[model samples]
Target: MINMSILKSLGLSINPKLHVTVLTGAGISIESGVPIFRGKGSMWEIPEARRLAMRASPPWNNKETWEFYEWRRKLVSQCKPNAAHYTLVEMENYFENFCLITQNVDGLHIKAGSKRVLELHGNMWKGRCMKCGKIIDLPETPLKTLPPCCECGYPLRPHVVQFGEPIDNKILIEALKASKEAELFLVIGTSGVVSPASQMPILALENGAKVIEINPNPTVLTPYMSLSIRGKAAETLPKLWKSFFTD
Candidate 1:
């Protein structure tokens, strides 16, 4: 059981009627065996990996891009949702209003049975046609073609928000709306440095919402959090959920 003294010092309360919003990042997926593409020791930090990823974005380099996404899809397919994912799903059921905003492209939260998730980064399993703009589920791995085409014969690319690309306006609007209205906000496993998305916790604070931060290390938003719990999400979230909801 969590120490009540700690909760008192942190100014956190458990109320089922509260409107809650949770923002998650790569840290939550790390326990599920997903590799973060950015940050220290990330694959993208490697020179060759960065080169390939950047090259994969253009039509001229579509084959290389498709190969990379296919590899990622296979890895994601093998991963299972972790304890943290299940805890969030339980939070959704307990709260009167709940919105889960995630920066991960992995669909683990959805796979874990979270119904109100907003994927700030697009899903890796989906593909979008470059010409016709039709989105579809990518075919099975070891694809028959290097870069498959849409039914309209246009090139298909991974349906993700790539670096230098803007997030979908519709998704961003919804995220902002949720943040502005939440009564309790949770920041889990994010660096709290990435733009726009990183500003969410602050928005919640400005709107008079209480903020809880769960991360293994201190980040830019640490000082602003009403409660800062330093631990892995997979290790901490289940305990948090039980402490607050199960009495």
Candidate 2:
């Protein structure tokens, strides 16, 4: 259990008016039956699948991408919002200035009713036209065709950033700014190995936010944590919320 006294001493309260930003990874979704890709001891993740998402020939298009995304989309669609997700929504409601920055493209945060979410990686449910750049929401049901076509007759690709693709500068800028501006920042369920995502909490720390990490195991960034609460997010978050944010 997290020692609330230690956190309270750091100015955490039932309701903080301060700006709060949370960065979440796959571990939070495990209770929803979602496989964690980037956590400590995770067996495997999306790399193999992402590679399959790309095409072989000249254009190097996301030829098989549709296959992977469709499978992924169906997998995610089966998962529901867990307690941790609901707790974040409650936190968002309590904190006047709050933002959720998630590395997972699973779309659970939005589904859980968090309004100010920045999906650092785009959601699988969205796709962009390879030809005209028109982005659209993909259907939950199986597509009739392999690679869906855009209104312009061009192949569409999942909106998610490919492995080698640099994060969209605008999104990175927003996440960084949020980290700097936050008075309290939470890193949840991440192993802290991935770039950019791993860097956000450090920015929050340097900028003087009370940085907290909630994970089942200590990660590389554990050394820098102002306070580390070791536990699975599904179980820990709701308890933390009840302890700190409830009447």
Q: Identify the leading candidate in terms of TM-score.
A: 1
Q: What is the TM-score of each candidate against the true structure?
A: 0.89, 0.87
Residue-wise C-alpha lDDT for candidate 2, range 1-247, written one tens digit per residue = 6545544767766456788899998888777887665445443456665464453332323556577667667777899988899999999988888989999888898899998889888877777787798987875648777677788888777778777778878888999999999888999998888999999999999999999899988899999999889988888888766766433
Q: Please, what is the whole-model Cα lDDT of each candidate in the order they appear?
A: 0.84, 0.80
lDDT of candidate 1 vs native?
0.84
Model 1, 167-205: lDDT tens digits are 999999999999999878899999899988999999999
Candidate 2, pairs of clashing residues = none
